[model samples]
Target: MLTLKGKSVFAGITIGPLALFHRNTISTASHTVENPEVEVIRFQKARDESIEQLKGLYDKAVQKVGEEQAAVFEVHQMMLEDDDYVDSVEEKIRNGKINAEAAVDQTAQELADMFRHMEDAYMQARAADVLDISRRVEQQLCGGAGIDFSKYDHVIIAADDLAPSETLQLDTDRILGFVTSSGSTNSHTAILARTLGIAAVVNTGNQLHNDVDGLMAIIDGLTGMVYIDPDEDTLSQMRIKQQEEKACKARLEQVRHVPTVTRDGRVIKLFANIGNPGNLPQVLANDAEGIGLFRSEFLYLENSDYPTEEQQFEAYKKTLEVLEGKTAVIRTLDIGADKQVDYFDLAPEVNPAMGMRAIRICLTRPDLFKTQLRALCRASAFGKLAIMFPMIISVAEVRKAKKILEEVQIELDEKAIAYDKDMEVGIMVETPASAVMSDELAKEVDFFSIGSNDLTQYTLAIDRQQTALDAFFDSHHPAVLRLIQQTIENGHKAGIWVGICGELGADLTLTETFLRMGVDELSVSPPAVLPLREKIRSLDLNKA
Candidate 1:
């Protein structure tokens, strides 16, 4: 029996036959082609085919996982369509007179190397993604088959390191779990595993080998242990533990429809944050009372250029229709800083976190902002829809945003389009300035949603994305709590509702504290809703 240890990305016990995944070898020999133009055409055809394949994967992933994680496929498609990447491959093909496969391999290697040398860890991690996409194109050029695991049933997939695309393409039903020889906790594959609720252990080094394929294996995700051909005693113990864990999850599922009420009979709204309509299934499955943070950036991020008004309208309409009258607070286009889109042509900033992001971008570019407002307004007629602006610092920003929204409403009215005239408007109190001035800001909108993540970051002067500053990035710091409390109190004074729609909202340790502070709602990831509901049910807020 062989034993391996690694970090667990998700906790579950899965026992199955081990299945080794191997990519098809693509020949990238530097053979000179008779015609460079023909090679370029071949590359284009292969690139197009690869993109089509990614689209199918994206749709499948949406059904298996949620849209947020499925978005990796969309990003892969974007990477393939990137002009620089395409131009580099074509240039290499023409200059070197090499075959399409050779050109793509060379370009991908150069780009991956550049990405590996990037300063940001996230950027460096993308080197794997570049290689993954390039491999797909190469496979197509060489007429080679892609990785296929459908023949295996109930198997633990063991790979050197599964890329996001490779992980998503697998038939998830056949996958009992995943054990990788190498991967980080922050890798997209890890994120997808967690999203899919699959048992996963990564970074096991070179311990896993192809020789063990089809061997009986047990993955103890809770302990990050993998046992191959385990003794009867170990297998029996794991089987019992697996049943117990399953029971625990079933118990959590029992609270799916329970109201989030404190012992003292105080009720709080529990909603889910979503990026697109594709996440609706998770939101419904988790029994979210509403959609709190309907991020509109996905529409822009998934597309090559600005998404048309019609495209935006359809997406919002579908989400609202899916909710069947449940409230959906849709935030306007918030693309800058960490969520940058190249088409925006935003000038580089020294301090992008504090620079043109969220409301700042919308306010500065009303034409771009108006298209989204029109879509939201139009979709409001489908169901209960609310518009919320992010990164608001003052009442002036809110008023300016509202002014553009009002103009969109007027335009819709002139066009004889229907909309909800009483649709609620709100702002995200994600900055220290906004939280401090919440009393005045709340008066301009129907409600306030405190974005605890950004509020904590700006208040502490710490970059939330900087992992090195994690020890100092305290979301529960007294100052952040004070700001949240002050924001809630000020919103109440203005006769407006206040909610938390950030990572801190899902922190169960702070659930009672938030309830005591008179928070009206808590919006978090879909998976957190039932657990938060259970926590709320157990709390007697009156004791405070």
Candidate 2:
């Protein structure tokens, strides 16, 4: 028996025989072509073929995943047809007089290398894209057929790494799970697998050999552990685990459209916490009542610089449009600390978590804050939109934020821009001070959202992002619970509703606790909504 540890991208248990993934490598020699124009034409023909291939891939991917995920193939198509990419290869063939294959490989390497050497991790990850498109063209030039994996079934995939295209093209019904030797939880393959609700273990450091293609294996995606040829006892335990997982999933589906009312008849609203509109499909698929938290900073993070008001407006508008009358509570410009935008050129802070961030940055830079506020307000008329401010510590800060929002409203009114004049506004009660003073602060806002992640961090005085702090960080600490209880009570006292929007909201163990405490809403990740609803339906909060 052999065991390997990796990182988990999704949580599930699967037992299956291994089916290895293999890519065909093409090698070419630099031949001096007689006519440079003929070499260019050859490249063009191959490029056209690759473009058609990607178009087919895009269509199929859209059917399997949603448009957001299928966009990966669309991006691959654009890369193939990029004039700069084509011109670069043509320049090599026309001037250097190299054959089409050699020129294509050389040109792809140059562009891929540039991205690989970037300081930003997000840009560096894009290097794989350049190489992926190049591989398609190179395969055509070498007269090789592309990847095909339709023959495999009832197996766990053993891959060096799966590109998004490969993951989308495979028959997922037959594929039980994935074991990749090179990938992170942040990789596109991992993201797609999680979105598709598949079990995946990544970065296992190559345990399976090519000859061991049919080895019996058990994968525990929750623990990031894989067992090959395991002992009888291990197999028995894994079988039980798999059965329990199946049972749990079946129960969750039963409550897919059911209201989150406890056995005691207490009602709890379940919402989704999404960073952007890309997660809306899951939000709808899981039957969430509304969007509890939309971290709008994502628009800025993905851009090289600050996003324009129109750009932010379109993103916010589209997200609300999909809600179809369900509320979308958007938090404005919560950028700082771990999630920083490069264009901001922010200097390293000794204690960034406790320093200028979220509402502080928005308050200091009214221009940046107002730009996002105007976008959010302008988009309000299109659908149900609620604006929330983060990192609140005082009633004065809440008043000040409202003042800026009023200024944006005035500017929009002067331009005759339509918006929800009576839109709901809220504040995140993440700090101890905010919780203690929530009675006063709640009077200034429409509602309160307790950001449990940050509330835990501040109350426990632990840097939640630090690996070493994992041992000390406790989300369920008495202090954190007391603050949450106090904030909810205060919001109610001030005649407003309160919700919990953080990792703790998804915690099944806390479902009864929050329900008994009268938490009006629980907003967690999309995948947790159905399960939470199941828990809610099973609980007797009155007895608790």
Candidate 3:
């Protein structure tokens, strides 16, 4: 028996035969071409074919996983069409007089390497996207070879790594789970795995091998452990664990309609955080009380260009309408930092986390900010909608954003556009400065949603994206908890409700702590809603 440990991207238990996933490697050998123009045409043809393939994948992904997860393929399509990327490939082909395959291979390497060497971990993950798209184009150039998985059944896939597209393309019914040698929790593959509710363990290094293929294996996603050719005792234990987990899930269904109230009569709102309107089905299925953090940036990130106000309005309207009177707190354009869009034209920054991002960008470019505000305000009439500004550190920034919002409202009023005149406005208490100034900032906004992810990152002066600092990137540090506690206290004192809209909100270990701190609400991923509610119902703040 061989035991390997990895990071859990999802919590589950799966027992199956191991199946090694082998991705075809593109040959990088350079060859002289008689005509550079002909090679350029060949490259363009392959690129176009790759884009078409991505479109098909995007559609497949939308049906399997919601549009929120499917949006990665849309981004991939945009990346393929990026002027710099296309230009680089053409320049290599025309100037170097190399075959289209060699030119493309060389360009992909250079671009992927650039992204890999970037300081930001999110950008570094994007290196995988570059390679994924390049591989698709190269496959098309090489006359395309497809992996036939007809021989595999109920198998746990082992791979060096999986791209978002690759993860989605695999037959989920046949794939009992996946164990990857390399991947971060932030990688798109990990995100897709979580969305699909598949058991997955990543970053196990090179422990997985072809020799293990067809061996009976157990993947304990809850513990991020994989055992290949497990002994009888280990197999028995894993079977029991799987049964227990399945029973726990069945128990969670009982809490679907139950209110997220703690013992001793403390009521809390359990909402779901969503990126796209298409995720509404999961939110409803999971019985989320409301939409806590409707990340409005999806409209920008998934598109090739800036979304029109009407486009934004339609998306907001659909989400709000589907909530059916449940409060949908939509954060305004939190773009920048790890989530960058090429059309934003943001200049390169040494440290983008602290650079012009989120509210700063909205405040600096009111034109862009107003467009989104107009959409939000126009959609307010569809259902309950609350606008939240992200990355606010000072009273001045909040006021500036509100001022722009006011301008948008006035413009809508002059056009006789209908909207919720009393739409609530809030700011994300992400930075320590915002947390410290929560009392005053809370007065300016109608509510406060503590963005614990950034709050902890900024408070500890640790880059959460830096995997090397994972040990030191303490999300549970006393300072971060104190900041959250302080923010909650200050918001309550100012007569404004406070909630947490970060990954920490989903952590069951802290549910009781948050309840004791008088947190009014928590917004987590849709899959976490029922489990969070169960945790809340099991906690008694009085005992704490």
List candidate 2 stretches off by more than 4 Å.
27-52, 77-131, 137-144, 348-351
The number of the candidate with the highest lDDT is 3
Clashing pairs in 2: none
- lDDT string for model 2 (287-311, tens) is 9999999989878866757899999
Put down candidate 1 lDDT per residue, 1-544, tens digits, no spaces: 8889988988889999998877787799899888999999999999999999999999988888867678889889999999999999999999989999999999999998996664344456677788889999999998958766666578998888888977776667778998988777757788787777778999888556668989999999989999988989999999999999888788888787778888899989999998677678779988999999998997886576899999999999999888998999998888887777768888888888888888888888889899899988999999999999999988888899888899999999999999999999999999889988988998899999988888888999999889898888888899999999999999999999999999999999999889989999999989789889989998987684
Question: Which is the winner by lDDT between candidate 1 and candidate 2?
Answer: 1
Candidates 2 and 3 compared: the better one by TM-score is: 3
Per-candidate TM-scores read 0.85, 0.86, 0.89
Candidate 3 lDDT score relative to the true structure: 0.88
- lDDT value, residue 343 of candidate 1: 81
lDDT of 3 by residue, 1-544 (tens): 9999999988899998999987666676899888999988988999998999999999999889877778889989998999998899889888989988888888889988987775545566777888888888888888788666665568899988988877887777778999988888767888788878889999888656668989998989889999999999999999999999999999999998977887778899899998778678889989999999998887886576899999999999988878889999999998888888778899999899999799889888999999999999999999999999999989998888888999998999999999999999998999999999998998899999999999989999999888899988878999999999999999999999999999999999988888888899999999899989998888877773
Per lDDT, what order, best first?
A: 3, 1, 2
